[model samples]
Every structure is written in C-alpha cells, then in structure tokens.
Target: MPRATDAPPTATPADAGPAGGDHLGHGLRTRHLTMMGLGSAIGAGLFLGSGVGIATAGPAVLVSYAIAGVLVVLVMRMLAEMASALPASGSFSVYAERALGRWAGFTLGWVYWFTLIMVLGAEITGVARIVTGWLPGVPQWGVALVVVAVFAAANLAGVRKFGELEFWFALVKVAAIVVFLVLGVLLVLGLLPGTDPVGTTNLLGQGGFAPEGVGGVAAGLLVVVFAFGGIEIVTIAAAEARDPQRAVGRATRTILWRILLFYVGSVAIIVLVLPWDAPVLQEGPFVAVLDVAGLPGAARLMEAVVVIALLSAFNANVYATSRMVYSLAGRGDGPAVLRRVSRRDVPWVAVLVSVAFGVVAVGLNWALPDTLLGILLNAVGAALLVVWVLVAVAQLRLRPRLEAEARARGEELPLRMWGYPWLTWATLAALAGLVVLMLADGTARGQLLATAGLVAVVVGIYGVTALVRRRRAAA
Candidate 1:
C-alpha cells in the first residue's frame, strides 16, 4: 500500500482533536457526519431484514420499530451530550475510562472492537456472495477478498478522501430509500397512474395488527435493536470533524429523525403495500412493493441497491474499526505500534490490522457461514447495548463535572441531554428491559448467552493483563 510522505504530527492534548502525529485528519464536516450516520443505519439489514420483522410481528412491526427507534434516539442524545463536551477520538471508550476506570474502558473498547471485526466479516461475506450470484463463476472467498482489499485501499487514502468515498457511497442508498418511500406512499394512496390503491386491508386483515401478539413484538424488538447497531459511527466520526463540538451537536439532533424515517417510514410502506404473509415476503418487502407497483426491473434494481448498501456499510465499518483500534492503541490498551499515523495523518497501521478482521470474516464466510455466523453476529451486536448502558452511566457521572468546569470557565455547554438524570436513567432502564426481553426470546436466547460469555472473557483478559504488567513493573 502507498504511504503518506508527510512528517509526523506533533503531540497535542488527548482531549483535543486527534493528537498531532496520533490524530486522524479533522476533515469531516457536519454533512459528512450526518450522512455517515444515515448510511450506517440504512444498511443491508433494512434492505432485507425489515421483511423478517414484518413476517414475525405482522403489521405490529411498526410498533416494534417505534419502540426501537425511540430507544436509539434517547441513546444518541445521551452519547452526544458527553461527546460534545469531551471530543476525543475514542468516543465512548474514552468516556468509560474517564467516568468508570481503565478496567471499564478496556472491557468496552475490546468488546466493541471484536464486534466491529465480526460485522466486517459479515459485510464482506454478504457482498462476496452477491458478486458470486451475479458472475456465477467467481469463488465466494475470492470475491470477498477483492471487496475487502478495495475498501482497505480506499480507507488507506487520506481522511478527506475516505469521507468523500463514504459520502457518495451513502448517497446512493439514501436516494434509493427516499425514492422507495415516495413510490410506496403513492401506491398506498392510489395516487399512482393505473394503480388500485393499496388500502388498509393488508395491515388490518392479517390476524389484526398485533397478529403474533406481544410475544411476537418482543421477538421483533431484539432484531430491531440490532439493526440500529452501526449508527454509533457518527460519534466515532465526531472527534475527527473540523468543528467537533458543533458538528456533533448538530448531527446528533438530526441523525435520529432521519434514521427513524428511513426505518419506520419505509417498513410501514412495505407492510401497507403487501400483506405480512405475502408469498414473496421472504424475498424482501422493498422489492415486493416495487414489483407490485409495476416498476421496471424491480428485482435487478433491488439487487443492485442491496449491493450498494452492503458495500457502503463495508467501507464505513472499515473506517470505524480502524479508528477504534487506533483509539485502543493510543490509550496503551493494545499494541503501541498501532498508535502511529501516516503522512496524511491516517491511521495506516490500524487500518491494516482492522482489515485483518475482514480477512477473518472472509474465512468465516467460507466455513461455517450459517449457525456460527448467526451466533457471532448476535453476540457482538449485544455489546452495543452494554456500550450504551455505560454511556448513560458515564454521563450521569461526568456531566456534573463537565458543567462545573464550564461554569468556572464561565462558558455555557454547547449541547445537553434532555431532562438530565431522569431521562438518562430511564434510557438505562429501557436498555435493561430490552436485554431481559432479548433473553426471553427462544431465537435470541443463544445470542444473549454468547454476549454474557464474551463479556466474561473480556473482563478476564483485562484482569490477567493488568496483573502481569504490575508484577513485571515490580520485578
């Protein structure tokens, strides 16, 4: 890979934007962060998994989305409140370390790192399979490698270039989703030419809206929570923005609304367009609506759209995982070697190591792509719940200090979490309830157990490593 020829960056305070030599370029703008969040939310899951939610909960899936979307909004607000005050590249990891302790930071950071790597593999595997489906002759792992390599190279480019790549990649899917919503709305209202209106029958007729009962909604809730996993990338990107405080504040406010619209709005349209039990529901609700609405090339177009969504996610997650590892390394939680940045101020070494996860992902896709992959993805996703729980805790602990510091300096806080401790505690309770619900579901039970096991391993690693280093120092 090509390297940056620029001189090493100077050391700056850890609280400020990336430390000189250790920093990512502050080239990101508000639009970049906003779109990145949007791109992260509208991934292959929405493109495909929404159909499953519909199938499982029937029209009551709308309620599932509403419940999940509200939780995401509250979680983001809590995160943004802290992030705006303490803009560090490490985001929540730094917050945990500050409010909790090194043990807390190490646990959350590595668990999040592992989750990102596992997801990267899923992304590569999904895209590779898509390619093999189209070409018919190419091997799956081979194509997966090519996709990972291409994005790795793109990520290796300077930060501004990575932003541009993500911006456009995300734009394609955003446009597709918007067009989908418009067409769906028109079809539902009988406003489109030569089309009978898709009335409320599909939503009302299917054993009533909550056809599967509250248990079904509970099942769908677990899936909904996982779908919102990648949206946290916005906060990760926040520390690299030119105006970290302002950019993060603005993006946090708008990103949630946009994500809700894309998820809730689009899913509602699909359910209204076709009954939950439609024979073709398994294919994807988005495609079903397009086909029924007499759209040209619906199947082929959706395939292309899905490919774009996965590739976009692949690119963004590569950027995310690299930065995350870079954060861990910077804190001396991992290899010091990963702390170095390139001439362009890119975390090149970290990029390669993160891409190594993609390599792991490819191998997984080649081997036990079924049960094992499902279990791993679910377990890793559940970690996001832990990260969120800690974020709220961190703010409850840190926000008072942040406010006091601002007062001594005689400056007003730029962003705030609504209702302070009250809302924050409520969000924490909601997260806890969601976890219990997740554990209760038969399908999701395995994943929750896997998460508990993974958490134990992470804590164990931290404890043993800390003990060894302390003894070595004493010796």
Candidate 2:
C-alpha cells in the first residue's frame, strides 16, 4: 500500500502547476538554470579549497575528482528522474515525502535547511577573508554583514532577479575557467607565444602521480566531494522554473558533465603547470598557477575573481535556504509564518528567517573564531551525503511506479536513468563506499562523527513528532 506521503503517479501540485501552485513566480527559464548550475558548483571550493587537496594528494587529486565525479553523475541522473517527474518547491525533500514518507521529508528538509543556513555564514566568511586580501584594513565581520545584507535583498526582490543575477555570476566564472584551460593547453604545448613547453614534467616528476599513494587519494576524495556541494542547487531551483519538467531535465542533463569538465580540467591544468610539492599549493591553486605563468597583475585578478565566486555562492545559498524554509512551511512542517509570501510572490518571512539564522552564524564566527565554527562546518559537510542517499532511495522506490504509469498512458518519461534498478543500487553502494572512506580518513573522521550526531538529533525529533501525531489521531 502507498503511504499518504507518496502522491499517485499522476502529477501533483509541484508537477501540475501554476508554478507548483505555490506563491513563487515562475520566471526562470532554461538559460538561467544552466548558468546557475554552472556557477554554483564553481565557487570558493575550486578557487581556494582545491589547494588543500592538491597539496595533500599531489597529482593524485585528479583521481579523487574522477572518483567523486562519477558519484555526482549518478546522483544527478537519479535526481533528474524524480525532479523532472515530480517538480516540487522543496525538491528532494518533496520527493522523499512521496517515496519515503513524511518523516523522511521532514528530516531531509530541515537537515538541508540547517546545512544551508550554517554554510551561509561560512560562504560569507570566505568572501570576507578573500576580500581582505585586497583591502586589508576592513574587518571580516563587517564585510560579512554587508554581503549578507546585499545578497539578502537580491534574494527577496524576486526569483527572476535572482536568476538573472546568477546567470551573469556564472558566466564570469565560466569565462575565467575557459580562459585558464586554453592558456593551460598553450603552456603544456609550449605555445604560449614566448614561453617554452612545461610539458608533463610535473605530472611525472611528482613521485609518479600518486606521490601521496592510494591513501592520500582516498583522503583527497573526501575534499573533492565537498567541492561538489553546490551543484545540486539547480534541481532545488527547478520548482520555480518556467517549464519545471523540461527546465529541470535539461539543466540536470547539461550541468553535471560541465562540472566534471571544469573541475577535472582545471585540476589537470593546475597539476601540469605546478608540481604537487610546490609551496604555492598552500593558497588558491589558480593564483599559484597564474603567478607561476608570470602574467602581469595575475595575483590581483585571481583574488578579485575568487571574491566574486564566493559572493555568487553566498547569493545562491541565500536563495536556496529561503526557498527550502518556504517549502517546508507551505507543507505544514515548519512554522506557519515562514509560509507567508509577498506581493511579488516571494516568501518574505522565509527570507527573513534564513538571514536571521545567517546572522547567528556570522556572530558565531566572530565570537568563537575557532572551535564552534569547525563543529558547525563539519556538521554541514555530511548534509550533502544524506541528501544524495535520500535522492537515490526516493528514485529507486518511485521508478517502477512511474514506468508503470507511463506505459499505461502510452508515453515515455521525459528523463530516465539508464540501467534502472541496477544503476541505482550501484550508486547506493558507491555512496556507502564514500561514507566508509570518511570513516577511514583521520582528517574526515571528525566531520563524519559530528554529522552523524546531528542526524541523530534530527531523527529523534521526527520520532517524537510522529508519536504525537499518532496519539492525536487515536483520540
């Protein structure tokens, strides 16, 4: 028997919508989604955090990207199926509600919400620190507050404005990477006008590509997965797209592969240009590479680009967190006040709530500056893992039912995962492997444990909520 949370095969409010029958305006188009996805995944992680991985694993970091990239592809394939078919405001959480039940939905929704709200501060903190490089006199907390205010307004104005802003933000990031890739090939081939070919000396010289060995590659894989965090935002934004079904399908299809290109390609270029043992690996890999190339003013240019990228993520997360809160509120899982929308059909209360929570994160960063912030960041790290697990599970449960419906209707699904049950199972196994890797890696162990403890509390809250609902129903 189907649970109440699982809607029938026929399209529900999310799929059969005047923008999912929610108050949000449906102004986003295919272009916005494509660019948004492109931009979201290419932020501070690539610009700054890649250094940590490259320095740790040396040239073997490429292998880490390949490993994590495969998992992201599988997860997105599963996501495209559910999102294209269902198309909800809350996305994975809504899918979970239908496939796994209300408890699952509530759990995923709030967990993700908490993660975004917390990451919001971190993104702002990244922006603050990055900008400080350019203007050393500014206080980090002040910059954080200013950016939070600026992007918060951008989010509240309207979904369309947010989409447009993301489109440009993503375009700048894409252009920068494409230029880097071109210059990279030129350098390798010794075709950069006056420069001699650096060739593959770095790749071979660095202790035969796996200098840190397989164990180092495993550790790097954990960091690489974290880099892939923001790619899922396109699906989350799918509910607001003009053609939710087609928009999500196209975005999902195009976005993930491009991410692999940028990430893998960029990492390849960096390693080729600079040896893994290079001291520059301690900072932004892009900056380190450009500085090695001796391009005039490269350092300042790289710093500016990175600051823009971090702020872009800050804007995207602001939009995502608010929408998630609104989605939950609309479904009666969150406080009713968060469900309130404005004349523009924007969730005003939800935006305020998210920004308010972000303020708390900012304060924590300012106050503790060390211990508590680490715990907060690590807690959010496990969020993407839980989300991907639920997304795959939801698709696995929903697939057979969806196929049966499509056959009855004499039509094919707009998007389908190849190898169905088998592929789905394989993806789950792969995710399990990543989790085990997290357990094995000493550096990642704390994050895994912290995230697990956070999940326990959320699950416990759901248990109590379910018990109360049952008791009230019995009366």
Candidate 3:
C-alpha cells in the first residue's frame, strides 16, 4: 500500500499564541510534559488496582510488572522516535496513517478516543465516590457533574493554562510517590523510629514467591499491564509543547526509569513489607504499607492522594481525547466542526464534544450505577494494547523511510528506537502473547472480545464512509 505523507516536522514555542499556525496551541513546556507523563500513569491502577495483581501472583507480581514496564519502555522509545521526527497532535495515529494507511489511523484514532471517553466516565465516577465519602450529604452524580464541569472549563481556558494546571496536578502525584518510596525504604531498613528490619520475610515466606505458579504471574501481568495505559498521553501532549522534539525526547527517556522505579520499586517494597496474602492488600497497598509503618492518618492521606491521582488522570485524558478528535477532524476523518479553535488556539468544539460523554455518563452512573459503567469500562480494557501494537507496527514500517530521509538531509533522527527491528519485533511478540493470555483468561476474555468488536465497528464505519465518498465522486 502507498504510504501517506508525514506531517511537517516543525515546532513553535507554546507562547507563540494564535500565530502558531492552524493547529493546537503549543503551550506545554518540558516540565508539563514530564509531569503529565508521570501523573497520567500513576493513578488508581497503582494505588487501588495493584493489590489484585499481588493477590494473584504473590511476590512474583514483580515479574509481571517488570515485563509490562519493559514493554512500555520499548513502546515509548518507538513512539519517541516517530513523535520527535514528525510531531503532531495525532501522535501515533498519524504515524499509523503515514506508515500503513488512512484506514489504520482512522481506526486507531477513533478507538482511542472512544477508550478515553469511557475512561473519563470512570475517572469522574471514582473521584465523585471519593468526594462523597468525605461529604456524605453530597450526591455522587452531583459531584461527578461538578468535577467534569470544572475540568472542562479549565481545558477550555487555554493550552497554557491547561498545561500549568496539569503541571501542578502531576507535581502533587509525583511528590506523593517520592514520599511513599522514601518512607517505604526507611521502614524496610528498620531506619524508621522503633521499627525492626522487615528483611525478606514477607517476600519469600508467603507461599514461596510463585505460589500460584506461572499461571499466577500471567494473571498478574494481565492485571498490571493496563496500569501503564495513560502514559501515552505524553506523546499526544508533546504536540502542544514549546519544542516538541526536545520535550518528547527528554520525557520519553526519563519516563521509563521513573515509572519502573515508581511501579516496580513500590511493588517490591509492598511485598517486602507485607505478606502477599494480607487482607489489607485488597483495601489499598500503599495505604496499607503506611499503616503498617505506623504513620498517623495514613489512610486519610492516601485517600486524598488517590483522589488527586484520579483527577490528574481525568484532566490529562480530557486533553488527549480533544487533541485526537481535533486531529481527526483536521484530516477530514471526523466532523468539520470539531476542528474549530478559539482565539487562544484551543479546539473548543473538540474539547466540549470529548467531555460530553462524561456529562451523560454521570447521569448513567446515577441511574444504572452498577451495570452500564462496568460494561463501558470493561469494553475498553484492551484498547491500550491495541494502541501500543499499532505504535510498534507503525514504527516498524516507518523507521527505514525516516532513516533514509534523515540521511538525505545530512542529519540524524532526533531519537531512535534501541535495537530497531529486533526489539520492535520482540515487543510485538510480547503483545501478541498478551492477547493470547487475555483470551485464555475468562475475565479478560470478554474485554478482549468487546474491544475487538469495537475495532470492527470502527473499521466498518471507515469502510462505509470511504465507499460513500468514492460513489459520490463517481456520480
């Protein structure tokens, strides 16, 4: 198939204002991109969802996390290479179009947008529940509506304002994780006042590592892999950065080790400090660790942090979904109205349309709290995997052309994926293996099937639309 041409590799400072061409505002600084990468990924998945992985695989959950972390690193490295070379709001979806075809980009973009919309609903619902816990008289749906409204207004303000808001929100999350890691290390070493060395008792003592065996570790992998989902927002956000190449390079390089440290490091600490079978793991592993360390008000502090994490993720997702649809509209794959921008260069129509689901979902949550939300969330469980697989595939297809273009220009690419075809192939293999595992696991099977159905629907729509356009031209 003939490849689509790449987006021009041009960038302007975020302060360039409305003069920065007909595109999303370049309002994100390096700090905003960096912190957004961190904050976006470290959400309820780590604080609340990780315990399920631990319960499934014992201390061997670290292996699951390690595998997933390495995959993310490889995937990000590939994305950094493409994103730096051809920065665009569409990010990997654009790369898919260039490397594969328009159909690939259209499918990936719409599916990802749908995934984020569903996630926005879940995030708002989670945040609302947390707030309702603190203020009992407040209704959950009311809190959800207010939270959605506030974030939507913040996003509509302007890209700079949104970047600044995300920067501060992410800072809170990163600081919380750093503090937790520091305290966890001290507590483990018996350095905390009045604590004995925990040693490796909890890690090896509880059913000897892989108690549930390889099957358990595989189950754990399924649980923790999706935790890495939101980090891809960095690439999407990179298009809005003052210097896309520099910002993407720095963020992708550092995000890997930081996520590994935050995720694998934190998980290692949790298992080392507390037995895998401890009932408290189910409640919240980080909070449980602090409680064990005898930190006063640990539960409340962690609860507040979890709320912050969810809100931060919600804010980032709003930015990501809007940019993606705006990119689609710009390419004539979506409604033309979605391409409208404000004086501040914000895609106002796209922003509102992206968050529209959250508003409707609030009512859905209020009406059918149990069934509808779970089905929506579950349907998108495997969406990130689909996106990652496309990123790897697009990188594989585009790398040679990119390298040749770089040589023709007498310059080197801004970033290159380490090991090229070898590592990229390995990442694809691992992703395929993950799909097999998901298919085999009863709980994950439904999600995988649902996602496949979503992909099919997207492709079908693209096909029908293409046929209609061709017929109209012929007529």
Which candidate leads in lDDT?
3
In the range 1-475, model 3's lDDT, one tens digit per residue, is: 1121223334221222244445566778888888889889888999999999999999999999999999999999999899888788888989998889989999999999999999888888788778888999988889888888999999999989998998899888888989999999999999998899999889998689898999999999999998988888888888888888788899988888998999998999999999999999999999999998999999999999999998989888999999998888777788766777778888888899977888897897798664665666776769998999999999999999988988888888899999989999999999999999999999899889889999999999999999997999799
Q: Residue 234 of candidate 2: its Cα lDDT?
A: 84
Q: Which stretches of candidate 1 lie over 4 Å from their true place?
A: 1-20, 365-381
Error of 1 at 182 (Å): 0.7
Clashes of each: 1, 0, 1
What do the candidate models score in CA lDDT, each in turn?
A: 0.82, 0.81, 0.87
Clashing residue pairs for model 3: 14-26
lDDT tens digits, residues 67-137, model 2? 98988899988888877776767888888887888888889988898888778877777777667666888
TM-score, per-candidate, Cα-based? 0.94, 0.92, 0.95
User: Highest TM-score among the candidates is held by which one?
Assistant: 3
Model 1 is weakest, by summed lDDT over 10 consecutive residues, at 1-10
Q: Lowest-scoring 10 consecutive residues by lDDT in candidate 3? A: 1-10
lDDT of 1 by residue, 245-320 (tens): 8988898888899889989999999888888988787887888899889888998888888888889898988888
Give candidate 3 misplaced runs (Cα > 4 Å).
1-21, 370-373
